[model samples]
Target: MFERFTKDARSAVVDAQQVARAAHSDQIDSRHLLVALAESEGLARTALADGGLDVTDVVARARASIEAGDALDHGALAAVGIDLDEVTRRTEATFGEGALARAGRVLRVRRKHIPFTPDAKKSLELALREAIRLGSKEINGGHLLLGLTRAESPGRRVLADAGADLERVRRHAEGASEAV
Candidate 1:
């Protein structure tokens, strides 16, 4: 399936891995793939822009989602009547600035290779299917964008949060691919 990917599609996959690593994620998820597609110069980016989505805002929201997951303990403690903010202030005063963030950072395990999450794998497979359905010989970034729009994943949610209409984006991507 990888062999069927065009250069831009292949590059998007590589960029997704980089995004996952930067976010300290153990797996390459749909959000990472979305960021990669948005960052790259291709039909995907153009389609997203045409749908009135800002790539920077999408990236920020995706990263915030990832960070929110990593900080679940903050919410958990609050539920248990613990004040994380006060604790952080005292800890930082005792241990110096950024003590809480530093401690949280230390808990993350760095991996030599991060594998794709199931949704991400499914999205890529869908990209291939989209290419075939469109009578294309190879999967390209446009197909990947179409796949993302079709999938029920965080990437789709990110697109929505960034003010993109999935149907409009999908049409734009298909139109752009036809022009190509």
Candidate 2:
């Protein structure tokens, strides 16, 4: 299936892996893919922009979400009346800056391989379907973006949070693809 991906689509997939690694994620999620799409220059990016979504803001929010999700024991300690901010500050003073975040990154890297999350996998599969439906010979970034909208995934959530209308974005992609 990947063999059918255009150069831009292939690059977006590689970019998604880098995004997942940078976020210290155990798997490549839909958010990572969305970030990749937003960063890329193509139909996907244009569609997002046309829908009134700012790519930079989307990337920042996605990163924040990843950091929040990856936080270790902050909520649990807070429940016990412990201030995680103070703990982190003291720990950083003793060990070094970003000690906790660094430790988490190390652990995440030690896994050697990060697989795609189920939602991400589904999005990729749907991308293929979208390409076929559009009568395209190869899958492109627009198809990938459309696939995210078709799936119930973090990518879609990010788009929604950024005030992008999925249907409008889809139409823009389709119209752009026809023009191409």
Candidate 3:
């Protein structure tokens, strides 16, 4: 399957790992893949741009998801009588400001070769299926984007949250794949 990927498609996969690492995530998921696709030129970028979604915003969303645990869940913990804010305040007071964030940064320094989450693997598989469905000899970035839209992953959720028209993106990606 990898051998069938176009250069842009392979680059997107490599860049997705970079995106995951930048987000301080231990594993790459579709959100990271989507960010990679959005940043890269070609059918995926065009499909996202046509939907009025900016690349910066998409990357930000993926980062937020991956780094969600960087900060304690104040509200949820507060409901359980664990005031994370108070804990942070006291910890910071004793350890100096931004101590927790510094620790988080240290812990986030992952080694090379971050692995993909199941959803990411599934999305890539779906991308191959998409290429086959479209009768394309090789998988391109557009097929990857279409795969993301079809999968139930954080990327798909972010796309919807960012007000991307899923059907519109699909149509545009399919059309664009033909031209590739």
Candidate 4:
């Protein structure tokens, strides 16, 4: 599948890995891929610009505490009487400050390579499908953006939170892909 990716598409994937690593993420995910696409200097970026969006603002929105889901989960636990905050407080009192926070990550060896999360892999597969659907011989950054828009992933959520119309981006991507 990678063999069919244009240089811009491949670079977006590579840049996603770097984005994940720089953010201290254990694995690359769709949010990182979205960031890479926003930063790409080609069709993907042009499509975004066509929507009157700022590349920096879009990237910032994608990077904005992807832990939003974690916060939602925490709220759900609270509603269920789990009270994670209280749990953390008690655990910290029993052990020490920041004990629970530092439990698993500090002692383990940090990886030199971060693997793609399931959502990221799915997005890549969807990109290929988008390319095929557009009758494009090779996937490009616009196809990657279309892939990100096609699925329910962190990338899509970030775009919504940033006030981007996903359907508009999709149209733009498809147009750009057709042009390519």
Q: Highest TM-score: give the candidate number.
A: 2
lDDT for model 4, on a 0 to 1 scale?
Answer: 0.83
Q: What's the CA RMSD for each of the models? A: 2.1, 1.9, 2.2, 3.6
Backbone Cα, N, C clashes tallied per candidate: 0, 0, 0, 0
In the range 38-103, model 4's lDDT, one tens digit per residue, is 986888888888866787998988777554443226778878889888888999999899886566
Query: What TM-score goes with each of the models?
Result: 0.87, 0.90, 0.87, 0.78
Which lDDT value does model 4 have at 122? 94
- Estimate, for each residue in 23-55, the C-alpha lDDT of model 1 and write its tens digit: 777678888999999898998999888877887
| Ten contiguous residues with the weakest lDDT in model 1 | 102-111
lDDT of 2 by residue, 1-180 (tens): 999998998999999999988888888988999999988899889888887778898888877776667647688889999998998899999999999778888898788778998999999999899888888988899889988888789889888887877898888877665555
Colliding pairs, model 3: none
Off by over 4 Å in 4: 67-109
Candidate 3 structure quality by residue, lDDT tens digits, 116-137:
9899999999999999999999
- TM-score for model 1? 0.87
Error of model 4, residue 110, in angstroms: 2.4
